[model samples]
Target: MAWVVAGVVCVLYFAGTARPGYLLVRDFVTVPDPVLGAAALGRDGAAPRAVPLDAITAVLDPVVPAALQQRLLLVGSVLLLGAGVGMLVRSRGWPAVVTATVVATWNPYVVERLLLGQAPTLLGVAALPWLVIACRPGPYRSQLARALLAALPAALTPFGSVLAVATLALVTTATSGARRAAAVALPSLILCVPWVVPALAGAPTRSAAQGADAFAARQDSGLGLVGSVLTWGGIWAPGAHLSSRAEVVPMLAALALVLVVAASAILAVRGGGRRAAALVLAWSVPPVLVLALATPVGLSVMEVLQQVPGLALFRDTHRLLGVSVVGGAVLAGLLVARTTRSLSPPAVTAAVALIVSVVVTTVPDGPRRLHAAYTPVAFPSEWADAVSSVPAESRHVLVLPWQAIRPPLPGGRVPFLDPVPRALEPPTVTSRDLVVRRADGPVLVPEGEPEIRLDDPTQARRALDSRQIDVVWWWGVPESEPPPGFVTVHDGSQITVWRRGGDPRSQLPRGILRPSTD
Candidate 1:
């Protein structure tokens, strides 16, 4: 039953991926073979957002094809997520299981995150239901062990790791005492060492100056910030969510569902499963707290929190709403179970089917929207050729048109984070600052990634002389020619590779500062 629900959701959401091509959308970039460089280890001077996820991919490149691994991870994450939700409510009966599975997988949060290409983070989120079950009251040692084991998947990304610890702390405390919660929390936190160590060791002095506002949850629908989040639809990225979410009608339907689930959760506490229902309700607090922090006064509070090392990672508060999905699904399952007790089996089946259909079609043409948006793309041949053109001695490869997010590739509409750093052998340097386009104007997220400054010719020359950046892979047409010290080695229609010449002290040409065509 869980597999069926998962399959339906996956087919609806990612059917286009069945065709041969890479799932390159937004920040979701996959390479055939990722380079196991300093950046992958989070030793790069930038933030550790990719962290151990990149390192894990590089390590698995030998045993599994990167593309296949990615497909498996993405699809499998959804499957496991549905299955875990199903397992949580299986004791309630098949109807409960089905309701929980559908509600968990077929929601705005999952859809938005999938479209945004956050497979790793989603994978971590998939473990939440299982973590809840594992933390159930039992022998302290056995419960602690199962809880830690369940948390391993969420530890894949830094955000996921934090979420895992939070979930464990809450659930373990609910079932056991605070002392047991501490026991579980300490070990679960230790699991984050892969990212935490690298982040603390080499993270930049200045994190993103404007990231709090840039990544804060925005009102996607007619519902303002709080209302939008209640419906699980407020994402920072405009295009990342289902287009239907912008409509007042669908958002209203979603809000009604939220109210129904809340009422059902209260009934669940009074009827039975009080602890479970309360815990589910408790899960809503984190997201609400996050939304509170997103407010103007809350952002002022966040400013102080950002001063603490590594706290900046949670700037994107919407992602923290993931646990809310689990809560909503389980509570919805309880609603289905408690309401349908006296109904005939055939009527129950019909009722469940109608509910499922309504839940799916609420966002009209969702599957088609995903299919059209998720077209697979093959990497351009020039990209590989450009990397191969660089000399073996070049230690650092810098991608030009220094946008943190690359402009759309040929035949593609979605722009993604530059894949050059992962594709190349050398440690690659690119802009960490994200440029977000808004109706008003362009907002620059000054995320500090220490790189050669194009504005300061002397600084750029010094970086070249010191071999901090030995090769430049410029994509698209530059406003001006390469400065005297950069000799073009391979110039293709789209990609041009430049290596440092013997004379590194030459002055940079004025034309080098012009805005990139990208």
Candidate 2:
């Protein structure tokens, strides 16, 4: 029956991945830099400075095809998950049950990543539990084997390293024996050494700054806790726009069952299963604690605690769903093991039905809507017809703030600039860079707000003219048009293009227009 359940889950996951509706369009369109970093590595060896470079140079390089890479990643995650489940089933009945519970309630971010092609995180998450299981007290040889298996996933990515360390610490406390603890801890520590060099070299500082800013934003905004819980726990509120209440009821019910299981685990700990109870507590508590600490003052800590850690990672908090799922699976397995000792067919059937109900209700709606809201906006698809209408080799073309274009003429290698300047700040750099690098030519300043502010238009114009910018793609007619001698060439759908005549550098501020040799 457990095998059947696992099989069903795998099938559903695969089906979900294949569905067109399941592809998260918005996330793909608004690819964050970290995600881009991974994608760039997967596609090409080097990181790209701009979207055009990424799309043309990185994506088109000799790296593995996108579809193939995605499939491999998906398969790898499932396999790791299955290995964890297998270890749980093979362990003592209580431990098996606890492990299963943790896996079943996996983070929604895992699913989102599957939908978005961010496979490294998924692989890492799936591997953490297996590592824990392998590190449990056992023969020295077996412990070493488990430790190795556990380290494999953690070693693959930076995010995985953090999760792996946290899981290792919990598992060490949960299991008995010095050797087992050392076996697990040592390998993880060793595997994490590489990250230290990068961290010391400056990665951590940048990461910390980005994380702090993101944390501040989350604190100010109420921390998106409710949304994270719904997305991961598969529950939906009555008035929430993303999902139907009916669709969410089952998940809420599953969550209730999980709570019941958690209670049982607590009771079991009191009776004798101290290790199992502690493991469950560790799995559930730290994420919540981290979130609380990150929250800004004023919101009651008590109120914040109730909200969950969904806000910390935004849509990615769906990752916490994994912890809950694993907890539930463990609890279910424990119950089955305990009840089967004396139960008859009818009672067993009833028990199974109850567990199934819990599982069904807890599983969130698949990643379709989540994906739609966040996928990258494809330039070729969104603006192809409009771009096609323009004559090839035309040096200048106006593009809307929302419109996207591919670089080069009819797809040549000419340097293209977005008419409107893109927002180049962190937390979502790829999408911004993509917009900037796909212009028809260098002078095509983007048609909207420049991410950087200059003291005056004279400075802005001077900076542009200095860069040899010959054309301005204004999305909407600016409150004040570009200074005299710039001719408007095209205008439509919130976009206008202007050709420059006299150099504006002379009118610009020396501080702003003078290129720094540095």
Candidate 3:
């Protein structure tokens, strides 16, 4: 049974992730576990928020090939999604199994996110159902196994962790054996300490600075955003929007989608699955409320919430939408569970046909669409040239074009990404870059990498002297010149590398520090 479900998941997802593209999106950039303890930290910015999978990645960092490290998560994603929904309809017939798998796996919420390279968010998506299962009554053979499952999402993504706790809380309040649940949940907190301790210490991260709108649920009307999210297609990028207004078919499909959810919730309660039904309902509703408030009427309320320290963490409604997909799928699973009892040919045929029709409507030409959108890339030879110039033993390195920002994907024009300090593979240099998000950020660490403004070259020079940055690779943007008295060691079409010195510049151009446009 397990193998069959796994096989189906692979076949479905491979159409999206395999060959022509895999890990091709920007999300793969954050897979390096940048927050792992090191002698020098990245001044490039606060590391993407830490979660439990980071610790796992960190442990594997030394031995595993870098490409394989992230690929492991990519592979786990489909398995978890398959296994999670499988858990929800395990006893039901093959129609329930096939229908549940397709309904859960083929959604835009999953594929579009994969194209955007949001591995962690998808990891959370895959783990979400299992988290609920581990917390509620189950057939687990051991107490320790359940407890570990309870903590599983906690380790995957921050939002997933909270959602897990929320589900557990709802289940705990209604169950008779509250003591056992409490005891199980308490130790799971211990397991979360790796991520929890760092977060509680208030170690600065890029996440802390995000304004509410940057993380807002949607740019369109609240109701419209709710519709888009429901139909599996609300995204920050404009092109990704699957607008209902664009056509009549989409409008009817979305409306029908809503009716399906409402009907499934009603059916679950009537079908001796009240607790499960309530769990999905509890999970699904908040995303709409959040999107609504983020829109206008409740803007004032969100304003206050944004100000509260640590509250902005929930600001990203897109992440919430991804997490909510499971609830909707489980509800759909319940509806199918009602019909697939006899495993009759007609029942199986209907279920399979329905799932296929939805997939086609939502994601026409899936593999071809993916191929056009997600062509993979490799690091340019220039990156290799620059890293080689930096002495292997250098204590720290800083990068310029340091906005401490998340920019749109530059259309794959560059081989890798911005700020080599953050994305350098076969990472060699130690970095203590400050994580401040201000656009005109005042130089924080002085010389090395903390948003250095050339106007304050004294402080910049002092910052340079104090930290002694080896091989300052200012590559992504054009600059007028290398700072005074810095020896030019390596200059290339994409970057200018410099080491502190008392003498004049090298044979490279004395002024106008720009890389070749080509």
Candidate 4:
């Protein structure tokens, strides 16, 4: 039943995928065929942000279109959240399970992350409840395998890996013994090796201290920053939030809903849920503290913490809040079950209505968000021919305009990362720098990943001068004059491919290579 509810939510949430063209928003760029190269292996003088995900997509490219693959994964993630939460509190009864499913699936955190084009990170968030259930006090022989299976998707990104491993270690140790916990944690550690190896081997990408201040949680309503974070709605990106969150009535009602949920949490803890409550409390403290300290009042605290090695991973801090969310869902299920058993029919209906109203208020325009965030982008048909025309031996294709994020193109309504790198056959060099527009002004965030910025013609010539780039694919508006002494191979309306003299050896490390096909 919970699975059925989840399926409906996914259908409604991602209705935009059914529209024509690819869904290009922020970091969510999917190409039919991705070039597997040094960057895929985290050897391109930068951090392994995509890492194993790119490699996994390349391996599956022959079987499934990358765009469809992403859609399936995203839908599967929501299902995982619903079913996992339902299963965890199944003992509570059907009403509790269903209510928990709706609560967990339709919250501000999930919606905001979706709008931000971060389905990959949500995998780990979805997996947390399941990991808890799998690691519960048990003597089963297949515990290790079950635990690892649940953790696989979460292992795709570093942040996800952290959440998965932490859940495994804590839950297993608390319910079972430390020995069993260690047994499960070992393989979870092994699962993270794909990204861990590259991060350790590659030149370390320096994390900016200013990012702590920049990405701090913002106050979304009259409820303020703490209230906004408590409701799991305050993402730093204004565009990512639902506009309804700005209203007073909805926020107050949302606050009432939070108080009721808090009461439920207390009831659950007092009634034999102490172990689960303890785990949730432990997980909540760090994220809440970090998020609070990232604000203006605690800027000094953040500055001190920012100097700590590897602290860059938690600069956003809000990502870790999923633990509390999952825990809260479990508690909420207990609340529903208890109410159903003791309260009158009228009371139960009112309770259910409260949950539904809060969700509706949180994302008042669900379909609109879907349409806006997943706006279809039609790449020129000539892109295929232009990229194929590049010499097979060419090392890097330097894409021009040198910027990362782009405003709405001819057929698109949302901003997106340049898709040339993923769409083209050869490995491409494009900007990783992100320009985030804030209320004050636009701030150019230099790529934390250690990639060379071809921000100007001088930089482009330098890359060409070094004889590292054999092809220059200029797409969209021309940012500057094309590098000198290069012959134009394909000059179509949308893309123009340029080839320089001589085949230069690739200075960047190489990964697995696949044959190019239409």
Candidate No. with top lDDT = 1
Once fitted onto the true fold, the runs of candidate 1 whose alpha carbons sit more than 4 angstroms away are: 138-145, 202-205, 272-274, 391-393, 439-441, 449-462, 465-467, 477-481, 509-518
Best by TM-score: 1
Candidate numbers, best TM-score first, in rank order: 1, 4, 3, 2
Candidate 2 per-residue lDDT over residues 63-148, each given as its tens digit: 65333443455556755665565456555443344335334533343444444344555676677667667666767677766676
**TM-score of each model, in listed order:** 0.92, 0.56, 0.76, 0.89
Candidate 3 to native Cα RMSD, angstroms? 6.2
Error of 4 at 281 (Å): 1.1
**Residue-wise C-alpha lDDT for candidate 3, range 410-446, written one tens digit per residue:** 3342122343443343232322332322224322321
Per-residue CA lDDT of model 4 for 1-518, tens digit only, reads: 77987888888787778766777777677665766666666666545666678778877888887877878777887888888888887887777887788777877788888787778888889988888777766565678778888888888887888788988988888877788888888778977787777666533454555666666777765677788888877777767877777777767766765775688866655766648577458435744775667667776566555554344545667676677667777767767787778778788878777676766676666557866778666767886788688876777877665566666667776677666655554567766655555667655545454445465555555666787788877665343444465666888877777788544422221221111110
Segments of candidate 4 deviating more than 4 angstroms: 272-274, 279-287, 296-314, 344-350, 424-427, 449-453, 477-481, 502-518
lDDT for every model?
A: 0.75, 0.42, 0.53, 0.70
Q: Evaluate model 4: give its TM-score.
A: 0.89
Superposition error at 319 for model 2 (Å): 4.4
Cα lDDT of candidate 4 equals 0.70
User: Residue pairs in steric clash, candidate 3?
Assistant: 41-431, 42-433, 43-432, 43-433, 43-434, 447-463, 447-464
Ranking by lDDT: 1, 4, 3, 2
The lowest-lDDT stretch of 10 consecutive residues in candidate 3 is 509-518
Better of 3 and 4 by lDDT: 4
User: In angstroms, how far off is 84's CA in candidate 3?
Assistant: 0.9
